[model samples]
Target: MAANEKIKEKISHLPHKPGIYKFFDENGIIYVGKAVDIRKRVSSYFNRSAQHNKKTLKLISQIQDIEFTIVDTEADAFLLENNLIKQYQPKYNILLKDGKTYPYICIVNERFPRIISTRNKINDGSRYFGPYASVTTMNVVLDLIRTLYPIRTCTYNLSPENVDAGKFKVCLEYHIGNCKGPCENLIDETTYNQNITQIRSILSGNLSVAKNYFKERMAAAAEEYQFEVAHQYKQKLDLLDDFQAKSTVVSNTLSNIDVFTITSNDKCSFINYLKVMNGSIILTQSLEVQKKLDETDEELLATVIVQLRHEFESTSREVITNIELQLPLDNVTVTYPQIGDKRKLLNLSLKNAMYLRKEREGRQEKNKDLSEQREIRVLETLKKDLRLTELPRQIECFDNSNFQGDNPVASMVCFKNGKPSKKDYRHFNIKTVVGPNDFESMYEIVTRRYKRLLEEKQPLPQLVIIDGGKGQLSFAVKALKDLDLWGKIAIVGIAKRLEEIFYPGDTLPLYIDKKSESLKLIQRLRNEAHRFAITFHRSKRDAGTLKTELTEVKGIGLSTAESLLAKFRSVKKLRELSQDELAQEIGQRKASILYNYFHNVA
Candidate 1:
């Protein structure tokens, strides 16, 4: 556990500021927690005298290590913690985490760059814009860009060298006049590049140059009595205007503004984000975030803003919302526009948020019904195969993760009606066995799990799966028998080598049908447990790399080092701070000690 001298040294330096903290074992992130005072919150775990419930004790027992990130305020802490929990999905949290990949407009990184809509963003020196909330809006914009510019839309390498060698040919796009014959070098590279420059500027919300350039050309053609050329420009200008009209709800004064509004129900929260470029709503979409920790409206909204912008690849610095909150970010402004176009955009965002909320709820209800039917089928199949009295709607599988007796850990994954019961999944530190003894670890964890359940009078799973061959299964059965729960729960041991199922006291193993849903469910549960355990193990190994960096600073005793770690969390951050800043937290004397250590000016 982190109560060891090294980890305690790390804990003492935890920042007193609000932040998110994670507990890890060899397997992975076991628990993630948010605290207003990270130092105090972390210190509580190691404080021996503190009263702990069974669950807290279970969590604390396995924490071989810890890590944390400091945020500016409590609100930031809440938001960051929620995001981390969703990302890492530590075993202890019950999260309503949901995510979807949105689409982006990529200007391909190539000679004669091709513009297209893609969900994948790879940085190969290509310019990428927008995870457009609406595919319709993105397509519409793409259409306008195509219509306005005779840029190549085809997937051709229009390199000058290739064109000179006559290695490529123009296709239907060139025949239809939708693209200049850049592939044939009929249009010079410099001339085609000029069109690309204007397209780039227009996409970035600066359309004045493009609009003026087209208008000036149109006027020049008409004055020269070239009516066809003038008419063509007029048509392109009109098409551009039509595309802008779809997005433009308000006047052009409010440009490059990101409008955000939040709406919520009991189950989930929705955030609508609208990016106004050149006073047009270039991007409009509402995102849904599942609320797990009962975070406030302000906190949700703030958190959603950070997530959506990053996910959607939005860069608009001027953010407008229906309500105001401290953004606590640099070079970004958060405002509540009460009137005029800004307010109108805000209302539009709110409307989208509300509509999306209702839409999502309807879809979820429909899915719940379908899921219920599917689960019933799977559970019924499991019940018959296991010969259980009740439906095996709840199942649990256990697995241990260890590599050469380093950071040994165990995990249990739960399934409810054949679906992952994520909130019920658990990870355990092997308390009784020091080395890689999977059998003893299994016995200890099984006993602990059932005993704790009995104490709390909680509902036990109908099925308990031991992820091992015969020997490990026997150990688990003994533990269950000791707890007087052997027959109450229908337990089975799954042998990984042959996928054979063994019942207690049965020498002959049950070979389930390879195609059976029951077998698949068991495999999934076992795999999930193994995955959970291995992930924790890797995180523990990674944290070990940073352990030795802090031991060298003089005047920093073990307690002082731990205190510094509890406050700073990172040696790099401590080294980066000025003596005055360091003095404010630690005393002036220690601050000088740290400053001199990093600088070593003598």
Candidate 2:
């Protein structure tokens, strides 16, 4: 009946086959893993005599349940584990952090198809190709396609019925000879379809087919003594040759291969993928995945291989990697080449991955240096401007928020070294103060904030900013004086109307130059505190409204009301929803009640 004994029994019954296993806690699945032998791999976690890292030990302690799926091969196990990790987003799996959707060339499926580039790949019978890595390269291909075949750029329907009915006019694209006016019936459907077929060949990286077609037409024109037609075909051939030359040519004999290489640091791994077609590199992409557990190079490479191949929609039968892997992909050859063009291709991919890693590291280092320098400069300027004894490295700002004396709240925003220290920020509901008494609310929050910090033996801020004129500032000063912190820590009040800074006992307020960095920094702190307070106030008011309105429905609770508010955004929108639409969100019974409530029906 014990948890450990149950886990042991479950492990003992695990099949000795390749599969993916999931470790679950009471809440949900926490980890997913792949194994060649499920029983052995699952048992390794329970080995009492072996030393486990803190994370591994923690993962073991939370294993309330285990579930697995048997697969036919290790590759299948790897793929299934990846899918499960993506679906559940388990805490202990390596996360692929790349969220970009590459551009694809879509040939619109219509009577007269138009080839264009798009980032969205919706399936409506349109054929899409090349989730291209470089927009410049994709544009080049698009230009070539347009130059070779004069397809329409306009978005007219161009149906046979529309053309026969004379419901369309020839656009400027037709006038400029860029489009063969299918809308005006100047180009037949069969001829346009034939041009699209050749374009498909070019986009698929089978340039030779398109070249041969042009060559045959040129020869036929020359034989017919049509010099002008032959010249045009010759020009098309020249354009194709120029485009091929611009591509990264590997070897004439090599075609339809995928190359992958990986480089990694302690925290993350980077993988580069190169898609080769017709002996040229057609696409190159780099991926970065954050490491959770201590995974080996082989494991990381395998995961990236599956992801990149699927993302690029690669159909190459041969896959080349920098290291040997037991992928066991059906009808696919996995190779690690040491000396040949394949090796060169793999080296190029590795260079790309390493370059990306170095660029990221360099950018991070530069940003850190710039941030430190800027922080020191701003803090030093502020200290000098305010005539403070110290640099005021830890500054806190307070602002009060209320709507006509309702749901009153205050916010305290902290800044360390001129940057927002969001973790140290606090929000206080005006517990002791009643009505729109800003001075009393300020006094209460200031007293409560530092009193708790002092009792807890936490460090106090170097500077405190009160977001009001002398009235609120005087109350905050009184609270600090009672706590014996007024002289030890510097405090000031900023007036919103004229940007006047008031000292504790000083009569006249100090006004730094309007363009001074020190004044700007103080403005930033004041604005941030006010923004935070306003956000808290709005949420509290919304909650109160939800309780008073939606929660009064016959069967609706707080959670249901919150859900309805989140879905419809406002009660007014909910009132506009039809009964069927409301039923789709909630059940019919609740929807009927809500509909009747909104409609004022008895």
Candidate 3:
């Protein structure tokens, strides 16, 4: 028997319960999988020829061993799967790295509190309506408040110092009738407060009452010979007409949904979302990211469902591209309705995704064609030109910034699919080499970079470009060779003699193929990385505050200090932690020690 077959046979006796599973290769790489029935789901994978797609086939072949845990139900299993996926980032799962928790819209606590969309949701004293998808969408709805009702947008506080400031002065918003000049106290507090309440009701979609009140106001203003006032009210009514027309229809049947889309480029991928509620599309956002190291479409869809479930309450039905999740949709219907309104909606969403993918892919192909032409032109003119083994998917460029090496820093910026991935930009402080030693610093940075990559097992970039000439190029090459990552990543150094580029590994000045989409793309990526790296380094060198307050904590050395600071924003906040809270935040022993240290010192 094969090595993996023996292992799978051993675990064949696993109970048929809902839980997470772990798959391991002989080389010891871990890939965690999950299922509702651990025994059945796992055993299914053991069958070599039993129907599997391309991605699944690859995963099954790599599986050398299997392990699982039994949970209470499928729902519990779903949560466990996502938790494990996030903690481990398994090789075969989609990963959501939004880097931000969702934002909630809150009406703060006060007699006249501000309605603001905030990422921080606190129960201190406020009402929160939503964890909206984007700030832009939330703000768009908020902007409608002026047209809906006469809400006071001004600060209610009339401090003694600013009492005179509230004196009448009709601002532009007032002339436009968007505001009632509440900042100038033209409107009384009682009226303003009443207006605020009405505005809130309108925002909640109480359309009938809002329209009735507006009609009454328009009629009353006309009777009072206030033509301008009547016209303003008439305009608001017209605005509401537009608002209702554009607003999504809310169906009682569809309470909550997560619409999915899978889009891809020449390299990497994308998965977008349209989170519906009460039949209205409440939120539409791309999944944190569509692709990870070894993530596939179906696998990503599954991971997204599990991860998304963590952020939301359990829903009765899930609308998907197909039945992919381990969730038992037997009682819950999984219908790909052929001739109905549902199918039409699904098809529309799919078409939107396909169009988005094509647009992205088209741009990339255009850039690729451009880059190739540029490469040819350079080769023709210089007789020595850069050649790639494959079309560069990830191109990296390095640039340094410092004040005479006093605050020496370097950045490694990355581009994927001819576009800059600002998220992947990295910076390094010139630690080992001293004072204007660009070559040695480059060598140190490159060495440390590859060393980290080796330890972390991260995918290497397709191409590496340095923003300097032969000496810097040689330094980078030497570092890569020393780390034995030389041939794995392409190395190129670009230098400008006035407006001309001098290529690495050659003495000749290079000329790019003006007509090549690919060559132009490379230039764009290289230039962007250089710009990004310089911007980051300058910002650091400009601000002399590289030190963190966590360094002052007695038990917290650099690593622990950084971790503590990152977890709790500041040393002051860390100090605010009670013994129990501190223990929970960090650890009991460390927390106690730090607390005592601070107390005794203070």
Candidate 4:
């Protein structure tokens, strides 16, 4: 490897401490690696005939810059490196990636802390317990907490000074019995802190203490003959037990084991993650990605494992998947279980992955069918409204722009099966029309268009839309009749004022439903023709102005002017050239005269 000055300078600063290093280039970070000794690992690339493969050598050559984060141990380096890889997806490293950050359960730091789930982690002295894989689990925790404790959900400050000064009162939460008037200092700080402590323990999967507390309270209430209070306590105890029973933690022996399962088809893949802590699945999440390069299932699964584990901050000693994956992760036992609780965990993970994949597929198919139905309905409505024998699947629209007759032009836009057909579109230069007469311009284009189609033996459209009121439509009809093709084609005119549709042999115009898809389609066709014609007219006017201005020169004529335009493309470019530069194309005398005219030299 060639050690450029940048690499040598960067390596000189590398410390001996273990850390994660990132190789950044002009684009961004392209490679990331973890090492025990930062200086030795990074400098190894600079040695004579570098001790690395072709890919590593290529990566080394592109390393314009480098950065490192110091961690205390090799384990910390591994965790941090894996995390950086997942986040940046450095091209040189192979790691699973996910698109989102899973939510966490946070207990806010306030006089009366509220239990809330969030994707963003704020370091404001609050306790955050998770980067949960599934929001459902956090939701269940919140519901149980609300039922077990009469905590305040309000945003009022319950500071001792504020409460003593009588700045706040009990709100709806107190009246509804969801809070114990904490803002009014009815519930002391000591009792509130104790409840919050137990809640933290419950979230950490140590639910026995909280359950026992609720059970004891229930028993005391029953002994005191307070049936309603006893019932409430019993309900809270049951909720905790029921939540635990659903997951069915076999034993509290397992901790920090990540189980993954993946399902993929020809075009995409989905993965499910199960974060097993104290033998119960604490976080359940599934993510899907579109298959762009047709990656193997094993490769995709391994990538997902790294991403999920790192994102949830799992430093599990063991990692499990339904498939036997050969990953390069160190100090982690990657296993495929075949029987017992481990097997059950694998199966559950697989079930979730498969279920999510199926649900996504169903939603796509349902959306496609609904879209097709809406299109079909629009066509049917158009057919009925226009009194057509069949659907007008092929439509043509025309618009004329004259710029007050300086360079009259027209454009025709075609729509086949309700979509713009650019290949079938045509532009007319108003060749036979003398001036800005809309009726005459429309008649000329219609006649020439059909006459050529007849000569070429091409197909005719089911509908020809004229963008004007009755006068343009009448001229178009006259042209069709002159060609003895009046009854063969279905033609209509759209009035710009009220958007009224004019039919042949009908005095009154037909007004379609304003909100109808048919009206929208018709409007789209008219607008497209207008946009196309205006663009062509502007270009023609520009070219005409250029032709007139260039021809006004003493020695320039039609061919000379067009040739100069062909070479220069525009007047601005010709104006930018020097006299000697212009003399290379034209004679010295003509160049001098052109330069004199432009520079205002008499």
- Estimate the TM-score of every prediction: 0.54, 0.64, 0.52, 0.61
- Local error of candidate 4 at residue 288 (angstroms): 5.4
TM-score (C-alpha) between model 1 and the true structure: 0.54
For residues 353-418, what per-residue lDDT tens digits would candidate 3 score against the true structure? 776777777887899899867655543332234556755666778777677556788878887655
The Cα error of candidate 2 at residue 405, in Å, is: 27
Q: lDDT scores for all predictions? A: 0.81, 0.89, 0.66, 0.83
A best-first ranking of the candidates according to their lDDT comes to 2, 4, 1, 3
lDDT of 4 by residue, 1-602 (tens): 33488788889999999998999888999988778899998888668435566666777788899999999887677668777876788776664445667788889999878888888898899999888756777787788888888878888777788889999888878888888887888988899888998899888877888988888888999999999999988888888878887765455676668888888887678888888777777888887876433557985676567666667878788888877876666778888888887887788888999999999999989998887787778777888888887787788998999876678889999988787899989999987778789999999999989999898998888889999988999999998999888888889999999999999779999999899899999999999999999999888887878888988987767786787787787788889999998888787988888888778889
* Candidate 4: pairs in clash: 96-303, 96-304
Better model by lDDT, 1 or 3? 1
Worst 10 residues of 2 by lDDT: 47-56
Worst 10-residue lDDT window for candidate 3 reads: 376-385
After superposition, candidate 4 runs with Cα above 4 Å error: 1-103, 107-120, 132-137, 146-198, 208-237, 249-254, 259-272, 286-343, 419-460, 469-486, 498-500, 504-520, 539-602
Find the candidate with the highest TM-score and give its number. 2
Q: Which stretches of candidate 2 lie over 4 Å from their true place?
A: 1-13, 46-62, 97-103, 109-112, 118-126, 134-136, 153-170, 183-185, 188-190, 219-228, 382-602
Candidate 2, 496: how far from true, in Å?
16
Shift of residue 364 alpha carbon in model 3, Å: 3.0
